[model samples]
Target: MQLEKDSKLELNDRSRQIGDVITDVESKVRKKYETHFQEQEDKIAELQRQLNLVSARSRRPKRGRKGKEV
Candidate 1:
């Protein structure tokens, strides 16, 4: 009976260790993905700013027509 109890305790300890490792790995992965997403967002914002600047510079001006004499 004592041997059975010791075996059960050992199994529980190993299970807890595995669970802790899994949690740590998950946290690291989440942080990495968040950083990657932010970088992509920043790049997109820069590209949009450049596009707006180019568009504004390329606009043509309209000329007023001369009025006809009555």
Candidate 2:
């Protein structure tokens, strides 16, 4: 009976350690993905800003010399 109890305790300890390691690895992966997503968001925002500038320029008239008298 005592031997069985000792075996159970050892198994529980090993299971707990395995769970802790898996949790740690999961946390790191989650953080890496979060950073990757943030970088993508920043890139998308920059592209949007550039697109707006191009559109604004296209909507404006040419400055100097279509030659219809000053």
Candidate 3:
């Protein structure tokens, strides 16, 4: 009976250890994905700003031969 109890206790300890490892891995993965998404968002915002500047420049009227608006 004592041997059986000891075995049970060891099994429980191992289970707890496995669970802790799993939790640590999950936390690391979540942080990595969060960082990746933030980088992507920053890139998108920069691209949008550049596109707006180019569009504004393109919409401006060109000067004619006498320096008048074409």
User: TM per model?
Assistant: 0.68, 0.76, 0.75
Candidates ranked by lDDT: 3, 2, 1
Clash pairs, candidate 3, are: none
**Residue ranges of candidate 1 with Cα displaced over 4 Å:** 1-9, 60-70
TM-score preference between candidates 1 and 2, better one? 2
TM-score ranking of the models = 2, 3, 1
Say which candidate scores most in lDDT.
3
**Candidate 2, superposed: residue stretches over 4 Å from native:** 1-9, 65-70
Clashing pairs in 2: none
Q: What's the residue-level lDDT of 27 in candidate 1? A: 95
Local accuracy by lDDT, each model: 0.76, 0.80, 0.83
Candidate 1, residues 1-70, lDDT tens digits: the string is 0123345567777677678778888999999999999999999999999999988876744445665432
Task: Tell me the tens digit of each residue's lDDT in model 2 across 1-70.
Answer: 0123345567777677678778888999999999999999999999999999999998876665875534
Off by over 4 Å in 3: 1-9, 64-67
**Ten-residue region with minimum lDDT total, candidate 2:** 1-10
lDDT of 3 by residue, 1-70 (tens): 0123345567777677678778888999999999999999999999999999999999999889999998
Backbone Cα, N, C clashes tallied per candidate: 0, 0, 0
Worst 10 residues of 1 by lDDT: 1-10
